[model samples]
Target: MTNLTCFKAYDIRGKLGTELNEEIAYKIGRAYGQIYCPQKVVIGCDIRLTSEDLKQATIRGLNDAGVNVLDLGMTGTEEVYFGAFHLDVQGGIEVTASHNPMDYNGMKLVRENARPIGADSGLKDIQALAESGHFQEMSQKGTTEQYNILPEFVDHLMTYIDPAKLRPLKLVMNAGNGAAGHVIDALEDKFKQLSIPIEFIKIHHEPNGHFPNGIPNPILIENRGYTSDAVLAHQADMGIAWDGDFDRCFLFDEKGQFIEGYYIVGLLAQAFLLKQKGEKIVHDPRLVWNTLDILKEYDGIAVQSQSGHSFIKDMMREHNAVYGGEMSAHHYFRDFAYCDSGMIPWLLATVVLSETKQSLSSLVEDMIKKFPCSGEINFKVKDTQKTIQKIFDHFADQKPMLDQTDGVSLDFGAWRLNVRASNTEPLLRLNIESRADQNPKPMQDYVDELTQLIQS
Candidate 1:
């Protein structure tokens, strides 16, 4: 029996051989079919080498359970979501490990209309079914068919924003050898026809399963160097990069400075609110002050949600939000069935900058100064529960307020910190944000104190 330790809070992610394999993927697919019992299902994958094999096995399970499959060959997770909603299918699945290492693989599941299935939702049922290792058999076998949704998807995406309004802006795009390169290629061709003076400086655009060095996660300080260098070398207006499956995007300004996802969230929120005034915007609890402030200023309703794609999407749908964003770079749109997209954010951002005649740097400069944050810090620890309890106990009495929406968030007068354990890794992730202080000493002291407490 395969140990389902990897059945996480959000999705199923684990090292390839020991925890996840073809058999387990098949069982998951079978269980998913039994639970959802959809007439038609759509499936897709990233560029990871294991993706195709896992997709095939998963399809086998679905077919065995008499569920017809629409296999979207080699597309991003969002594409699967789009296929599900566009085709009016009952459910969808994307076989991807996202930004994890090459040795890792996972699945992102969604119900009809792109509703996410996380641990609190249908994930636990799927997990139990997989563990039981016994499922009802279907008398009739299902059929499988493959289709290319790229051309239609690209066409549909282009309709959202007008390229004619965009000024000719030179930009650098680093795919980091992930699945984003192909999508970029399709968009570049369309941009050419619009007479947009957009020159794309590409690097590591090819999809390589080995990932040779590391996964294409731009959140890491080390990964930013490559993209920064590309921006400087090309002297572009801005730089954009995506993770393995192109589900989220990272940006660098013309000066090669990496922009935080929080600022991007604000920018996107403001853009959406300007067009659709009074529309609700859903944002994660982590680092939401900037987003909330912007939304309120724009007369947009701000809805705070737990930090996760599943939660954000569900909340967005319930609120009928025009947009949803997370500090982790996931951006969701009501038009896209409330599904997060790695491709749309950059496209929309470019349109925003181009139409306004403002550089990306200038747009986010004020927000950065207003909310100085120490980008997420991860600490490897043996006992996540103990560390969380220690932090909670230490600050519970002294802090003005404490919340456990995502993890442990303590708010003081002008400063807030959230410490949450990663669902996929054995580490505690800490995020701190604060308003202007007389000096940086207080924040530094707080970080030092927390570090010492955890280390000691």
Candidate 2:
């Protein structure tokens, strides 16, 4: 059996040539076809150069397995997700590395209704089937067709907000030369037709597999300057930058300051709550005070879920949450088949700005002051569990309330700390926050103290 290193905890991602290539992708497609035996599936690829070749190979395998395929051409990860749930197809696959290194490539898979196929879901079985090189011969071959899901997708996105409510605003959009450009163009045209006074100052707007301006991951501080600089230069209302597959979007304020995703959770929760009270809002456990605080004021129910898309989507379904958000910038919507979208958040944000008549920074400024967070800090350690336990032992004397929902969360009266091992990496991710009223000290002090404990 050929072990496949490309299959990760949630999706398929690997270095090019060795771990992933046309042959391996074809086997994966065949494996999925054999296991699920679906009659039809929708597929798409990102801006990566190798993505198209691998996508075609996968299509060939699926066709050989007697599964009809609908190709959406080049698209973001969420587009395939949209196709899976919105269309009549039984499954969807997006060939994308999604902000990984330049030499890497991957795929994200979903079942009917856009339910993710993760490690605990069906990824392991798919991996095993692919590794075994087993095949179930079909009597006949299936056909392939080209489909355009864009118009329907843009129409659905417009449902999230009233175009009339959108006021005159100049916005900066940096696609980072990834797959987001096409969607942005579609939305731009829609805005023009609707006569919405939103102006888009686009940079790195073209789709380029070469990634002229790096990998399009704005989460890293270094990658943020392009969007920030443009926002400042244009004095735009807001700045938006997306990753390679455009599944997650990061936002910047009018001041060109990168806003933490934690605060945006509160902002979006407020936006939803303003529309309807007593609705459920799901959020990850990493940062909670801001979201909980907003939910409390808006009379909305708050549900905490472990981090990651699979867990968030499950919790959203269970509670029928109107919306869900993670500090990592992945936002989910109940109407969108509980799948995360990089497009919807900015739209909702624009709505919030219009209704509140507040600048992006002003909207989140109070929340930031009330509950200061240390953002997410990463520490590379030899033993993740050992380090987590050590931190637990240090804080045991204080007898803080601890919750192990995703990782270790210790809540003190005035402050709290959450440390969790990353699902995709060996690093221990830490987040610390304090109520400004209860503890007025600098957030850096908490960072310093944790840094000492973690390093020691």
Candidate 3:
């Protein structure tokens, strides 16, 4: 029996040979096929070195379980979701590690209409089946066929934003050597047809499986320089960069300042609200002041949820939310079956700027000043539960008035902090937000105090 440790809370992920391999992937595929038993299944993968091999193994497993496969070769996570909905497939699975290190990989599964299969849903059953290593034999094996969906995906994306509406602006786009470059190249051709005077400066735009340096995660301070340099060199209106699988994107202003994902969430939420007045928008509770305030001003309903793709997507479907976003830059859309996409957010942001006649910087200027955040700080600790309890106990006196939605969020008059355990790591994630009048000093001081406590 395969080790069940790789069966994560949300999806399957682990190191390459030791924890995950072709055999394990094949078993997972068979288990997913047996459990869902859809008429057809859509499969896609990122550009990690081991992805193709894993994909083959997964397809074999699915085929063995009598599930026909529609292979969307070498595409983003969203493409698989699109294929699932567009082709009316029974379900879909994207074999991607996302922004994880090269040595690691995982799978993101979905039912019909791209509905996610999370822990509470069907992932646990699939894990149990895979671990049991038993399955009913099929009368006839399923078949596999390859289909290229890039052109179709690009065309669908363009429907959301009119290129002619955009102003003449220079933009820098860094694909971080992921699968986004091909899609971005196709988008550039579409922009040319509209006569929109835009320059696209690109870096690491190739789909290299080696990932040369590391998975192109822009959140790390080290990766910021590449995007920042491109923005400055081109004197562009803004810079947009994506992670390894293009499931999440990061942004930079013309001045080369890294914009927080929370701010983008508010920006995009405001944009959507303007179009559909009083529409419901879902957002994570980690950073809510600016977003909630903006939604209220627009007379729209603000729905708060826990941070994570599965949680946010589920809430979006439940509320029939027009849009949803998390602090991690994962953006969800109603039109896309409530699935998160790294490409659509930037496209929608561009359209928002075009309609508002405001620069990206100008749109988010006030939001930055309104909510001065310390970003997310991670602490590697021995005991995650004990650490969380320690922090919760320290602030227990103020617990009655605090927000305990997803974690322990304590509010003072001027500042607030949210400390929660990471679902994917052995670390406590801390986020600090301060009011406009308060100096960031107090926030920093609290962070220092908390860090010391956690470390000790």
Q: Could you give candidate 3's per-residue lDDT for residues 105-124 as a string of tens digits?
A: 88888899888888888999
Model 2 lDDT tens row, 171-205:
99999999999999999999999999999999999
Alpha carbon lDDT of residue 453, candidate 1? 84
TM-score, cand. 3? 0.97
| Total backbone clashes of candidate 3, pairs 3 or more residues apart or in separate chains | 0
After superposition, which runs of candidate 1 have C-alpha atoms over 4 Å from their true positions? 1-3, 437-443
> Candidate 3 regions off by >4 Å?
438-442
All candidates' TM-scores?
A: 0.97, 0.96, 0.97
On lDDT, the stronger of 1 and 3 is 1
In every candidate, how many clashes are there? 1, 0, 0
Better of 1 and 2 by lDDT: 2
lDDT of 1: 0.87
Clashing pairs in 2: none
